[model samples]
Target: MESSLVLEKYAEKNRFYREITEKILSGKTLNFEEALRLYQEGDFYFLGTLANVVKENLHQKRYYYTINRHINYTNVCTTNCKFCGYHKKPGEKGGYTYQVEEIIETLKSTPELKEVHIVGGVNPELPYEYYVELIRKVRENFPSLRIRAFTCVEIDWLSKISKKPVEEVLTELKQAGLNSLPGGGAEVFSERLHKELYPKKIGYQRWLEIAKTAHRLGIPTNATLLFGHLETDEEIINHLLTLREAQEETKGFYCFIPLAFIPEGNELSYLPGPSALKILKTIAISRIILSNFPHIKAYWVFLGVKLAQIALLWGADHFHGTVIEEKISQSMRKDTVVHLSKEEIERLIQEIGGEPVEI
Candidate 1:
């Protein structure tokens, strides 16, 4: 009876996107051509309505969040990603690296932190032990804490420095209590953007390879795409489809996060950022395309709390976390607010008629 009611509601609500909406409701995966049509031609409300159908179908009313602290252990980096405003040279005035003790002390001082999000610039000066011991010490200090740390780019860098395979590096980290891999460092995957935006970092294929390798090793990972920069609609579609193909094979990705590129302090500062409508459309399209992905996060750090709240209606089920000190987004120094406490985050979710879920 409940299923019939949902089906009737879906049928009535999706008239604007009847063809594609029917296909989605029938549990058929959309093809690339159809996805392109939705991007080029679908109504914003229709697309969002379709996406919300999928979201509620998968997760019901439970919107997920976590009590996590972002620990950017170092600002000293070697890569020259043009979109990055966070990395600094070793001798730069603001460059800093936290000792293991400092990280543990920060965690100890903070209360009810369920997860620790750790990412940093690719600093060659830090020894292999620095990376290994960081995870070990954190695990020792907080045995129950979930550590969602490192990007594929960072993992590739570690593989280079430790002279080990990506699998080995991930294995050691997992043994040291690494819970999962965060999806950062995956900007747009176009070759043109690669040349202009992040020539130094590994390309999309290598990033995908690293992610698949991690999944094969039983390490759950998240995937992301940074949009609203110098990428065409086709390139954005290509990025989503590529991740969808990956998820089909491994079934390891936990969530898909669409990061809006903030061009305030970076080399791309001259370009305009994505509008709120475009952000919402991107979220909706991501949900429509990456059907295999179980979650979509509207990262409140990049998207302000208000916009992130709006994203829940569009299709996003996750709102990142409390993010005590989100340095990467903060480093941009844009006109963006940073960090929301658990209470505040809950209130924001409730205001949108969403049930804030923690796990």
Candidate 2:
């Protein structure tokens, strides 16, 4: 069918769809109601088309990946959030914490590494100095590598344990060679979800505060939303809008990643995870709503390689890097591959008619 015929049919069937399409193409912003309606009732194909237009307008045909590795320094956590499958209680049988030298040794083995993502559970056993020393040692060993470490949740825990303010903790870490913060721990922005799902972690207000503080200190960060769980459509839209408003203020978010919930080994194992349509719809909606976000990522670790390829056409511009190893998702699913070679990544992007650019 011709593109014109499709538009005509849609326009005749749904006037609001045509109106919103024109509104988006005219370079106008989507308000809360418009974005929410699109998320709830918009046609799947048309939604992807509109989101792809927005993506191309911002990033052209370029898709980005990075040569990075993830370091799960420790799994012993006290928080024990219900949705997490990676955390182990202190002194649990499988728990481990890497010494600073051990982390350096792991980094030394990876070739062509550009970034090291360091995140772990909220382990009460480790002293505050250990966190600083880890960053310092990573910087000492790999001076040129970008060190994206910690989430707002971990930072809040550090502040409490060290008897320092959040700003002070961030400043100390920055001085010790932290480049930026990752966008985990922001499960959703609703207070109801915060209390229901991750009451032990920091709430949304504190997360935003810590993120904006990092931005003010010249550290850029990414933002994320964990969907396909117990969240409603309104909660999802509100989460994106909150991030959009925060981005308007600080301009610090590097990317927005919509993480699909994997309900394998967690407490929510009874529930089925998000379907392919929901995943693609969420990605497209994220790109449409988060206009200030420079990139939208199709994190293959959660979405899988093939579906992630389809996501590239539906609004995502970043295929999250050659993560040498990621333990969080691996703990939940035994089939999760820990590494993807740069060649494999580029081939996957190119096969989908995308130009792979390594950042």
TM-score of each: 0.95, 0.97
Badly placed stretches (over 4 Å) of model 1 are 1-16
Model 1 per-residue lDDT tens digits across residues 60-152: 887999998999999999887888899998788999999989999999988998999999989988987788899999999899999999999
lDDT score, candidate 2, position 74: 94
Q: What are the RMSDs of all candidates, in order?
A: 2.5, 1.6
Alpha-carbon lDDT of model 1: 0.88
**Clashing pairs for predicted structure model 1, backbone only:** none
Among residues 3 or more apart in sequence or in different chains, the pairs in candidate 2 whose N, CA or C atoms overlap within 3 Å are none
lDDT of 2 by residue, 36-64 (tens): 99999999998887788789889888999
Q: Pick the candidate with the highest TM-score.
A: 2
